[model samples]
Target: MTQPDLSVLDDHFSAMTWGWVGDRGTWTTDAARASLDALEQLGCSWIVLAYATLQATPQSTRIDYAAAPTLTDDEVRWGIRESRRRGWKICLKPVVNVANGTWRGFIGFFDQDVPGEPTWAEWFASYTDYIVHHARIAEEEGVELFVIGCEMVMTDGREAEWRALIERVREVYSGLVTYNCDKYQEDRLTWWDAVDVISASGYYPTGEWPRQLDRIEPVVRRHGKPFLFIEAGCPSRDTSPQRPNDWTLEGAPSGQAQADYLDEMFTACAARDWVGGFALWDWPAALYNPADAAANTDYCMYAKPGEAIVRDYYASRRSG
Candidate 1:
């Protein structure tokens, strides 16, 4: 396959913003359509479609290799069509471990008979097939990008295998490729050779966020490559602490507090040379209503202050 240069950030690079798709879980075609409508209205150029469920069964893992998920294909296709219709880009990112740790089998990894947890190789071999299967579809469907993995902290060290998998994927698809990593593991990852961009799920506090990155500049300079903050999240509406000294905003009670923090981060990133782009951790307001919403706190970007932050940032980049 001819490898085309896919560097989205360059001197002529324009600013682009994307949000995490709302966590509506599984839905019928109608619900999915409604969700797409809502996201398009928000001016999202790219969307991360999630298909993993809280209780995915073993049978679910046997998704047809040739096509996207059948149940929500309409929703998936609607997202693709509408995004293309509006000149937007869509990337399919099916997250595993949504059930905390239970549904791993459904997404293909360890069998129920296995005792403790399955080995990383066991998971990667199976999961990468699923990812590549869908990725090939994204390629045919003309989607903008495709994610191979997300937040699988347990399997981060299998570098050689990951590189091989990405190289194989490159043969079938000619679009951007990346694996989303937890922020702390940014430097630990070694599979960059086969990937187009280095991405991480990172979130920072409200003040001088990029300043925290000064410590990593020497390491990054050594890599001689630009990085994307592919996933960074802050609580859009919460004033209380979720994690100790967590990056959540302080003093600002309204949703706007969250937006302000994200705005600061985007400004800091876009004005720099090393930072390519930032994908806000999530949008569509799921933080507040995660499954078992009453028991869990919310972290999504719906009507919250962070929503405006995204809108304004994109506007600034577009106009700049």
Candidate 2:
């Protein structure tokens, strides 16, 4: 299939990340429309649609989510079509989770093959299948971009496998491709040349955006690839800025803190021309009541002070 025109992606993309959960039926509901409408009102120019698959453990390769209660293939297609209809650029992000409750970043294998144990070879094979399945879908649907994987820290050292996976994805996906490295791991990816863009999770601590950006700048320059924060946001908790990546951090809800963190992040990133833009950590498939914003303390910026900050920032970029 011929790829859709994606020249529009050259500009800065203020994206709102959207992830689905629960049964597939929810994708076609009024709730989904309301959520997208809310995001569009926030002035997002792009939507990063993340679909998750699961494995029993980092060492286990059996990747399957279609059979689970998560979002279905039809739901994903609907999301893509809806995003396009709303004039938002689409980045299809296929993520893998561990069913046994391990974070994907901790997914690792022995340095060398071990007898009678699950090996890196087995893991990569399953991972490749999971990624390529969505790559083909992204191609068929003409998504503007495709994210090969998200924050597979332990597996990142398998340079040969990652490069080969990118090559295979290229055969099916005609759009730009990228991998979302975990925070502080941007420089560790030696195979940067294999991907079209350099992206990482921007979960640096509060007041440390400059230091992190400085650390990342040389890598972007060296690789000569456009840079973006594929995922970044602080929860609406008092101390979230100090550890933005920790979603479970406890504290009273503080929209002001979240808003301030976003302000700092946008200001820091905007000053650097190489920093393309951000796809904020997420907006949910289902939204909570706007009236309850003060009590809620997750990363979702909807109906909070952070939401306004994001709107202003994105609107400023659009007008500028």
* TM-score per candidate, chains pooled: 0.74, 0.96
Model 1 over residues 189-232: C-alpha lDDT tens digits? Answer: 77666677677665656664666567445546767665766676
lDDT of candidate model 1 versus the reference = 0.56
Residue pairs clashing in model 1 are 255-305, 256-305, 259-306, 287-298, 287-299, 287-300, 288-298
Total clashing pairs for each candidate: 7, 0
Could you say which candidate leads in TM-score?
2
Candidate 2 lDDT (Cα, whole model)? Answer: 0.87
Residue pairs with backbone overlap in model 2: none
List candidate 1 segments past 4 Å from native.
Answer: 7-28, 53-75, 98-117, 240-253, 285-297
What TM value does model 1 have?
0.74
How do the residues 1-320 of candidate 2 rate in per-residue lDDT, one tens digit apiece? 34434365667688988864435577778988988888778888999998677788777867776676557778889999999999998999988888788998888888888899888888888888878888888988988889998999988889999999998898888888899999999989989999888889999998899999999999999988788899999999999999999988889899999999999999998889999889997898789999999888999989999999999989888888
Cα shift from native, residue 197, model 1 (Å): 0.6
lDDT on C-alpha atoms for all candidate structures: 0.56, 0.87
